[model samples]
Target chain A: MYRISDQQVDFILADIKKHGIRIESLQQNLLDHICIIIEQNLEQHDDFEKFYREIIKTFYKEELKEIEEEAIFLVKSKGPFLLLSRLQFFLLLFITFIGPYITYDLVWFFNEGHGSVLPVEVWSGTMVFATFPLLVLLVLYFTPEKLDPLIPRKSKILLGIRPFIKIIPPTEKYASYQQ
Target chain B: MIYSSELIKGTLKTIVLKLLTDNKKMYGYEITQKVKELTLDRIQITEGALYPTLHALEAEGLVTIKTEFIGKRVRKYYSLSRAGKTKAKEKLNELSNFMETMISLLDIKPKTI
Candidate 1:
């Protein structure tokens, strides 16, 4: 077995940090794990830096920062919540808010006692109240990736008691790694 | 010879929790090796997924960690907390039931040892 020098260990740690892993414990975990692999595999004469880069590349698809992002995302998404995708949330808003108003108008139209035609204010009210919010939600849900800061295109949304609501940006790379 | 990434797509947490329950404690690499050994190298847990999940479990208070200095490196060991023990049982039961359901649904025959 090859023994890794302190300098080689330091080089690994710096490389991990430079790759964008911010959390200390996570950094250390990667350090120890990579060091063990090096000790077990690499011989003393081999190029440590090149071998290290080759191995770490397999850790992520795009970059190392995804791990930190995923860690933060999972922590925030925990506890009681209604997890929703983009389309589901949009439909939920429509059903909860707009559906009721449309139902009210339908019921009024067919009723024997009330007039067949809706008052102008009632039509205006539906147009005024429901349309604005519905449009806002539509825009928020469908906003382009660069333009939309709150919810990314593929992110999961959590609606809950504690945090009220949160948007977890998608990490499709590691999404399959967990349930 | 197969990698079970597709087969084990969503059961990483249950596996880890159960491992911690069976053993007193584990570190990141040890957990990976144990899984590989137990599964006959069919299931390999990646560092990208393992560290984050472990960190999340710690943040959620399902697991506790203690570090020891080994020369220049610090080795962190993880053990289940009181809540983690309860959680592990629940997750195991859940996964077991899910497997049973999958077996029934797919009408696959279980191989006898």
Candidate 2:
């Protein structure tokens, strides 16, 4: 229920900035929170500067720095993964739909005069290649290289079968075997 | 009378979600103070720790934040999104069940089953 003038707010902002809160949203939240804490203190204490100093003293400055660093990190690191996932999603979606039909036609074109049952090599190759995109997607989804974009960045744990998570798809290796 | 830091760490998310479930909306500082008051200062959620949780919750689509301008500063008030509301209930129920199980284990009565 207490209020301060613009000048006092500026001083509070300066103090927060000086302490190294760089994220814009965090700075804003901290500004409001600090002011409210100050107002609460003002009801009991007379001096703004002294009360403000004392309240911040209760906080771990390292923790404050951690908050800022965490926010920035969550944004910078996760932003790319989220984008990459979306791109991967769309790319895979496109291939899943279109790839099989193309593979079937290509297999048929080379072996048009063959009987109803296709050759084992053609059938097997088509099966592997057709399911390639989906297999990659399942691997990516389950063995998440990063945390869900929604989870806090600091909570990044290499979840789910960590040893097998870093699978390099057998596309190139399989191609070598084909030769 | 503060609780161990480790104990508080695991439960913080559920605590935040549960608090939001009970209240219409709460700001960062308000959430901290409420937790302190409710627990009689035994559980103090520091500003440093609380903000990350809130941000993470926001990212998870569990909570939606509304920013209001009061004079020169911005006040961010967080409320549960629809999914958040459901998640809050589930998390609290899970925690309640876990607590009951822990209590039963400590009591150590041999089961007839």
Candidate 3:
């Protein structure tokens, strides 16, 4: 029942910021919660400064950091899991497979018996070797928290593969050579 | 009497979900205060525990959050999602059955020989 003045609320908010809660949503939630507690103390005519100080003492900076860390972690983990579980991830997988197959078919149709391009077996082997690992890496990236520990090292390996993969000739280059 | 961390940890989500099922929606501080008041100060949920639980529930698609500004500060209100409502029912039933089972196992009925 003890109502706090706006200036007092501002001071409380500044105190929370000083504790290093950088996330906006978390800062807001903590501010409101602290304000509620301060006002509750006011109903008993508790000294504002003393009561506020006592309340702040309960939350060490590390604890506030943990809240922010957990929230940020959950948000980061949720997006990829949610996306991958839905049809979008599968659609991307489908596109990853069909896209290359369609291009190969188109190239074969255009270059039948011309012998101007790499054999289909060779091209297929190259696609599987060069691209399938990249695709698996993409799938791992979107997977949930269970695989989080593997992501950092896996990403470094993928970065190493980038130049080698890019060295493969574009399908368009192969098609144009026949023309 | 204050509850142990183990007890609170196991039951917190069920308590929060049941509270939401009854109240429709509640903000962070309100949920804490409501729980404290209902338990007559026997149980007080610290903010550290509450916020993380709420965020986890939100992440799991069991709760939806809506934000609105109160003066200059933003307040987030939480309510159950469709899946959340179903989960709440299932969880509450499970907790209730567990409690009854515990009581039956622990209670000593006197035998009138």
Tens digits of per-residue lDDT, candidate 2, B9-41, equal: 668889999999999999988899899999999
Q: What is the C-alpha lDDT of each candidate?
A: 0.83, 0.69, 0.68
Candidate 3 lDDT, tens digit per residue, B4-31?
Answer: 7557867888999999999988999999
Error of 2 at B105 (Å): 3.4
Sort all candidates by DockQ, best to worst. 1, 2, 3
Question: Candidate 2, residues A93-123: lDDT per residue as tens digits?
Answer: 5576647756686778667865566768876
The best candidate by TM-score is 1
DockQ of 1: 0.69
Estimate TM-scores for all models: 0.81, 0.58, 0.56
- Where does model 2 exceed 4 Å of error? A43-45, A61-63, A70-179, B108-113
B23: Cα error in model 1, Å: 3.0
Alpha carbon lDDT at A14, candidate 2? 85
> After best superposition, candidate 1 residue A40: deviation in angstroms?
1.7
Docking class for candidate 3? incorrect
| Model 3, CA-based lDDT | 0.68
lDDT tens readout by residue for model 1, A31-118: 9999889889998899888988899988887988888877776676666777788778778878997888888777777783554678
Worst 10 residues of 1 chain B by lDDT: B1-10
